[model samples]
Target: MSSIDFSEALDCLKKAQSVLISCHVRPDGDSLGSAAGMAQMLGSQGISAEIILPSELPDRYAFLFEQARPRVVTDDWRRAQLRGFDTVVIVDTSVRAQLEPQYDFLKSCNLPVLVIDHHLESENIGTVELLDPSASAVGLMVAELGEVWPAELSAGGAKALFTAIASDTGWFRFPNADSRTYCQAWRLLQAGVRPTEVYRSLYMRDSVGKIRLLGRALGSLELFCEGRLACMSLLKEDFRQSRAAQTETEGLINESLRIGSVIAAVMLTEDENDSIRVNFRSKRQINVARIAERFGGGGHELAAGAQLAGSIEQAKEKIVSAIREEFSRSGEPGGE
Candidate 1:
């Protein structure tokens, strides 16, 4: 709510001789970019910065790293790294719980735990918390910290931050995107990051397997709420049949919204263990987070998601039923 106190974030950065930045487990562009942007920005101040990613670098975002990759960590390494850093900054994630294994390490950090995130569900785990769900990500919040940023950050830092903002805000298509997102994006552009290149790298760079997986995902789609809702699922087998990784299905939930009469769209992916991961997207007048939260998940109103302990088909049915109930309240077919 208050202007993200870069003065506050800077104080922590300045105190640490060495800094470590971390993001959520399944690192999206915003999480990875926020981590890299912080590293580049702090490098300008002569501070050594590192990124600790929970998983391997996803394929599409590998290009963003030219010199270094996120230091992949085991659970033990994660704790040790969190302990050794002069300061640890958690980005893109609101609560430690969302980060699985690092949840406890972040809490026990001796120096300071600083949280710069945009998720509304944050658990406020840092000594210094600068979280605004209204903003697109911690990268956008970190971009505001350029006042204290070192000279080295002006270019690479901008690209990382811009990519984070662009991805999390659905390329600035979501309603949550505001003047702050666009203004910061324009600022990053001025810093010499090519918008077209970033776009090609982020969205346009999918593999052929990914394209086939998307088609299969769409083929499984069904409509509900008298066509106001659309939902689908892609199992692990679907990815194999399409010769795509699970990541290939990344944008399938978004495509569902393009249909006429669609008020809400959901895509459930069956992970290796058969537990379902849900992705939700919607137009106005529906709050996906409300539905996600009811099922022990969290995110924003317009776009939110959750992980469920059920079959993909069961998850899809539950989510679709939730959507039906949501629209019914509006005097629609399911209710109104």
Candidate 2:
């Protein structure tokens, strides 16, 4: 976590005339919500801020961009346009690898970077950082930053921040949603964010293809480590037959955790490039982030992801071996 004062980061932003904001590749709700919320907050101060995404925005999250539209980079030329901004604010991730192709551009731009994130094992790539791995979500931190500005959050900003905190903590159902998380959420509610409206927008609008894809994923569920570990895989063929977009795979891994005996879960997805995208989730006994780090990825203790080059079967073998080692090292049930 960064020791930089929250006020100091806000002061840096207060000095900027125009700012460019971004988040990690394959951004989830926390990343996108943080970016959107931050952009709205900066706009309230009369600072020009635009969001640039490394990948295409998922269809489900398109609502967030209506008020705070982002420019999704499609090529080298588009990426270059991110330069020349007065300041850069990176939210939800600080790792160079997570920043991808943007990291190269940022190196040459020589702009002062401010990182606001809540994740373990982050890299030092910020001029000022307000990181709190203990915090439930970066959106929470961003909301608190608004409090320091002593500005009442606009309805749009409040909704975006609400999405950030709710999504990261699984709509306040996950264990991470403590009193602080609820308090921040209540404040957003007071700011005119209707919980039912937001929930319908985020969860009740799944496509038919996504439902079929979920079925196939569950059909592939396999138990290992004496049923304490559950793993599922989805091949390109599965996506083809189901006609599901890749983004629909989000949250599918957590389905296995519903089983009483399962303490850990892994979801292996074959991307278009034939490389495997692995997502890990744990109920508490396992530190899935350490497992992801072994494969050159990092995230929270309970949830993490890694990309592996190889056929899905090959990726499965390597991941299973790693999970076995982690379970053994942790000396948990099914370790032997």
Candidate 3:
């Protein structure tokens, strides 16, 4: 993939008087943090910036957006506001399908579209793109951009950016976290971001319902591919019984990977439209992103996800089979 120069992206942002920043559906910490931090950074430069998300902001991330929470664009009135902006910055994700609700509206807009992301595979959906898979998170790329640009980041922006990087890198435990990631983290700390505060806000503050949901998810865990792969499914009933929102399923897939023998983990949840949302995580060596791409989804090597057009059972069978085949080809044997 061709990489867009950071300077070019900075120039594009400087030219725009107002920019609308957005991210994929079921917004994650990386997306939310990057969008919020970008908005804050742009605002500091005297540019009118706003963050519009396709889904509700998760409760855990509400603090990062307390100064100015992102607006959810689910209706025409909200969609109409897009016309007022001269630039649209799509952060964290570059997939059109992931944008949801806002995908069609963004396509209809005549303004310049700028994509800032760190995904492995990206759709050619933006007029100006800045994609670097080497970066730990889109927030780190944004932090780098800020360093090169004239605008100064506020304390809130630093915290938001820190959350983006920390969450995406699994708090520096993931393989994606390199020296540059640590350097960016140090830079953010210097910019007035409190590591302890951000860490507690993102991870330590779990709700009772969320804990119940996790219990349900863990109870459903099953092993496949000679214990190399761990799989779990959470049905609609799980959400209702646990009184937990779908967003609470955020970190459940990783829990499966904690098993020492499990090189890969998959979580399938029943979503709206009778489809299944699948999240894939790998401990090492496996390229889950390729599997996700084959299923029309995309992400990093160890972490990726896809939304399949089937029920939870069908999704589990198909995905498990795929993973088994992949493991077999890689010299591992056995499946269940």
Candidate 4:
């Protein structure tokens, strides 16, 4: 990654009258909230800002959009606003590979571009990349970047910041989260964010499809290397029968670790087009993100993902082997 001083990047930001914000493909809460929160902060400072979601916003976040109502840049054809923006900010994505088709065009823009992320693998996705993998959420960091100071978060801004931190940490339950995360969440709450409201925004409903998806996921699960490793795969037909959206496959990999002794587990799912996506989760003894990063993806040490070609069965085998190797290298799967 190239050198970037946020204090120096601050100059480009404060001077720009028009700013456009974006996040990586298949954006999660931290990216979405950071992009929108940055826009809101800029607007508060009397700067004209636009926020765009490169992919369709995930359904779980619909409540946040309804509540904040930030303008999404995708629909507005205003050429001047589009062309006039002097700064472009991308958040949560650490590398170009995560941004997909949008990264090249955005990177080509002659204007100032900044990236704020908390992923360890960022090899510089922008002219200025402010990365703090230790951070709980990009939204928490963006508040600092915006000079909002946790002490000054508005109700809307507080909600955004809180949601970003809470959702990404899996409600303070993720292994990546530490005392700093709770402290930050407390700070956000003091700024007027409601914990219950934000929690509801994250996980309010359970559709019949999601239940079916869960059943299908549990039914297809298999163990390997004794109980040290496990794997599961969801096919297009399984999703269709379950009435589940492809997105519903979230958290399937964690089922492996639920057994309390398994070091790692992987869930492979084939989307409608036959493309396979894999989610990997590891507990106390393994590093799943290390494995995921090898396959061109990254997340927390205990959790990560990768995409593969051909079939879910192929993806399952590959992931299962990776986990088995990770465990075996640790001196023979120590227990049952």
Q: For every candidate structure, what is the RMSD over all alpha carbons to the true structure, in angstroms?
A: 2.1, 2.0, 2.2, 3.5
What TM-score goes with each of the models? 0.93, 0.95, 0.95, 0.89
Q: Candidate 2: misplaced stretches above 4 Å?
A: 1-4, 78-84
Backbone clashes under 3 angstroms, per model: 3, 0, 0, 0
| Residue 201 lDDT in candidate 4 | 68
> Where in model 1 is the C-alpha error above 4 Å?
75-84, 148-152, 331-336
In model 3, residue pairs whose N, Cα or C atoms come closer than 3 Å (at least 3 residues apart or on different chains), thus clashing, are none
lDDT of 3 by residue, 31-61 (tens): 9999989999999999999898898888899
Pairs of residues at least 3 apart in sequence or in different chains that clash in candidate 1: 328-335, 331-336, 332-336
lDDT of 3: 0.88
lDDT tens per residue, model 4, 290-327: 88977767777777788788876767767677666777
Q: Candidate 1, residues 216-301: lDDT per residue as tens digits?
A: 88899898877888888888888889899876666678898889788888988888777899988888788888989999888888
Task: Give the higher-lDDT candidate: 1 or 3.
Answer: 3
- lDDT string for model 2 (202-320, tens) is 89999999999999999999999999899999999999999998889988888899999998899999998888999999888689999999999888999989999988889989988
lDDT of 2 at 262: 92
Q: Rank candidates by TM-score, best first.
A: 2, 3, 1, 4
Over the full model, what C-alpha lDDT does candidate 1 score relative to the true structure?
0.80
List per-prediction Cα lDDT, in the order shown: 0.80, 0.88, 0.88, 0.72
